[model samples]
Target: MDDRIIASLETAVGATPDDAVLRVHLAELLLAAGRREEAVRHAATALAADPTSGPARAVLADALDEGAPAPQAPAEDAAGTGEGFDWSRAEQEVGDLAPPMYADGAQDPQGRAFDVEHGDVRLSDVGGLEKVKERLEASFLAPLRNPELRRLYGKSLRGGLLLYGPPGCGKTFLAKAVAGELGAAFLHVALADVLDMYVGSSERNVAELFRVARESGPCVLFLDELDALGQKRSLTRNSGMRTTVNQLLTELDGIGRDNEGVYVLAATNHPWDVDPALRRPGRLDRTLLVLPPDRPAREAILRTHLRGRPIEGIDLPALAKRTDGLSGADLAHLCESAAEVALMDSVRSGTPRMIGMPDFAAALEEVRPSIEPWLETARNVALFANNDGQYDELARYLRKRGRR
Candidate 1:
């Protein structure tokens, strides 16, 4: 089958000598067939015709990754008659064959749909974080669903949200839920995406990201562990980090006023580590701290996670009481740990059935809250949080706890 695909690709390339699109397609097919060396040659040919062909460049990069040799022009045949190909005509034909460029002047071959990935934790899948959900609904969902309300109020909804909390407390999960709720194109911008070792590349990538978001309107750009990109300049020796942050700040500022449809959502465990400028009024204005689940929330989380399992003898309320100071994620982990115990029991006792209370009780020894480190950061955030400031909600939560 691979040989057939490669043969067809070769035939297509030969027939469409000047067609860059065909060449690129052939390159993709070759790459898929593990013919990296051949793919590189085709990609190089396509790029030679259309210098701005991103797909060809991407294919070339993949080929290079597989140690493919550089492409060279073929020598004359035994006929000894040098049939000089019209390079300019080939270039024009390839250029014409290429797909329409994005409004941001970038070639996105996979299109907007390419941004969506397979694995995603939906809002319904999340066990707890009721307050977090309500806040997101009010801030994000409400604004998106009722655009007219925002227009009447003369407020342009912009400047993405920042979710800061302990690890395993559902910050990332909440970000995913927001994307799912909005039904918008979700782009997870990794720290590496915006951070480059090259001098201006980091800044350029940041600008390109916002540009992509604008072109793909009603999109959500979720920057996870945003502190890596938005860290305080003083804390880093890498000049690239500083440049990236500056670029992000500029993009975010413009996005607030210009991007009527694009939404930016970022998550970080160490909010204090983030640059102060980013947390100010214009960048990530609305910050939400996802705390560990309370007793009621924990019980609800357990029940949600254990919905399909046969737990006839289990008492969720009692388990919730035992699991105090645990986050929603922690509860989920607990359920998983219990399931592991049940599996072990099934293997030992030959009864592959329900997970009893003993399984849960034993799992408790292994599952623990991941919120301790964030507690210190939350304390610092609380100190900076003024009554009238944007972090008032976070401040209130910390103050109520009183321990720090």
Candidate 2:
């Protein structure tokens, strides 16, 4: 039977590549022969050739279920056997078999939907960054909820907010928390999403990004690793990267003060690397430095992360003091590493149980800070200080440390 199926596939491949029916038949044969992965490839090719091909789609779905834990009804159960179920032909015969049309009209599929998308994280879940949270709430959440306050201000809220600091400092997490606090839609737009090889496609993606945010009012557009998209063209030799930055700038500038209900929250490790135009007043006006957790903040972070874990008495204050330069994310990772050490110890002793202080200390030694290089670069950028009060606190911290 396997040989017969292989012969059929060879014949099908020899035939025109556009033969959707033959492709589906070959895929089905391959699936029955236990070549599930190859079956999926053939089925996908068939679907690409004729998107409306129901038999091909059914075969592809069946192929996906192979070796998967979940139980799925066989194609025979769904469409019946020995009938050569051609969905395209069936749709043509019975007009009602067409694809469902959405009432919302044509729009960018990736865009935020105000009534649909919501944040996954809450302020309570954040565990630390109390001061930062309070500041953000005052600036964004307060004005958003109280329409009276906004009216009193008279001017519509404008520009984006940038969260810049060391990696693992909870910039992205804070953005999510803000979204949840405001009860607004959260659309995280990464640099990869807007990148394209084709001309105009990159710009189109940027337009779509802002367009979706506008359509979905009361939305938070979170751009992560923003330096990738907003990088200064002077540093890059690639015209494509420069074009992408220009497109981003144009989209940002287009969203003026009048565009209320849509908020842009961007995060970057290297704020200085971003184009000056993007950092201008109407673009990213509010630049919040999300620094590494201070002594008190670090203690809170350690306690929060270690809670409910089977740990042999941890002196959190001592730990916090030791982890002076660590970010919230770094602390979390350190805790994870400690847990792994405990797991290894348990396995060695043939007993699985709680982690001890020694385990944590050992893990701390193994897992050093990941942001040292980035921090050094940031220090260099800070040398030619524009005297923006934004850097005062960070500058003070750096001056004492003496540049990494």
Candidate 3:
């Protein structure tokens, strides 16, 4: 076959991709020219476009059989009924050619509807948030671990704890750590998990989330970005969002002890934006402030990020001292920037070099503390909206940092 003729047919097939007849013609020409792979692909595509096309089927079968050993012919009675066909191989060849007609809900492990996790990050693994750890132990872990103590003191695990602070400050990790301490399944829910485009679906999703969490008994249901999921009803203009918040409130206040063994932990960067009802007496009633990493935490964060990378003469203590107010995330970026500096320098000099203090100094010049803006916003909230003393800890921290 002339290559020009094959090219012309390919162009025609490309122009009218849905035309199974054109694709079959191209497949036949390609097959005749000994381009078996290209012939098989086109034939499979044609078969996918028109499953009943006899020419597409014949071409696909011929392309598939081109290099195979021949078997004795099938009995004449069974010839046209697919009895001698390798249907599985044919299906495999064309399986990915057709797009799916529909999509289902997202999948999870073990065929569950939600992505439940088992965390191994204990509180001890979390570095230098001693005050936060102490608060967790006293308010959350102690009560859960000592049921007798809880019963003796009449402390009910009926409400959730909200962790609020700047973004990228390890709130999620702290929630996971709490779950790890409880030795329970962790179901991390975000705003996207509950909201739906269809009416009433969002409410159903919220109810379903709680239902699954309840079924997974002794589970930690960690709601991330609570400000988005349960924003103040007064500020929420979308009726759908307000209803979703209402549904969440209903779930949190589960009927007749339906939420007995479920532990709720929520985190948000803007706790003030979270629905006030969510912080009522029996909901997420407790709040914890997570500030930027202190010196020791900064050192630990820098060490963790720099691990497994080539380094020399890096003074962690000095680096930690210099990065006083940087969040864990900021420290991570600083480490990354330092590595990039070393990498680019080595590339220019045509030699490898270890990441050192000089590279880190350059990174320091580029990656200033990211928590400053968050602290500024927090200062305003603490100074203005903290009439209830709900943010006293935040206020004290701000004052100590001279931001008040």
For candidate 1, lDDT tens digit of each residue in 1-404? 87887788788779878899989988998898887888898999999999999999999998887784677776554455556655655566788678534366346553442254324556776656677788888876787788799788766576678998777777776777777777776778878666767799888888878777877766788888888889999898988888789888888888454765678899887776889888787579888878777776778788889988867699878998999888777888899999998988889998788888999889998887778777776777667555456566677777787754
Candidate 2: stretches off by over 4 Å: 1-116, 255-258, 385-390, 402-404
Name model 1 segments beyond 4 Å from true: 1-114, 117-128, 255-258, 307-311, 351-353, 380-392, 402-404
Query: Candidate 2's residue-wise lDDT over 1-404, tens digit each?
Result: 77776886768687778888888888888898888988898899989989999999899888887757977444442345645556655566667655644446557465443233675678877655777877787766777778897899874577889999889888888898888887788888888888888988887888777788877778898998888988889998988888888878877777452346778999999887788888888788878888787787788788888888898778887888888788788899989999999888899999888877787789889878887887777676666654665566567667878863
Number of the top-ranking candidate, with TM-score as the measure: 3
Clashing pairs in 2: none
RMSD of 2: 13.6
What do the candidate models score in CA lDDT, each in turn? Answer: 0.79, 0.80, 0.89
Q: In lDDT terms, which candidate is top?
A: 3
Off by over 4 Å in 3: 1-111
- Ordered from best to worst lDDT, the candidate numbers read 3, 2, 1
lDDT of 3 by residue, 1-404 (tens): 47999999888987999988888998999999999999999989988878899998998888889868888766433245646666556666777996444556444443355778987989888889999999999989999999998999999888999999998899999999999999999999998888899989999998889888888878999999999999999998899999999999999999654798899999999998999999997899998999888788888888999999999999999999998878889999999999999999999999999999999999999998777787888999999999988899999998998987
Per-candidate TM equals 0.65, 0.69, 0.77
Candidate RMSDs in Å, in order, are 15.6, 13.6, 9.6
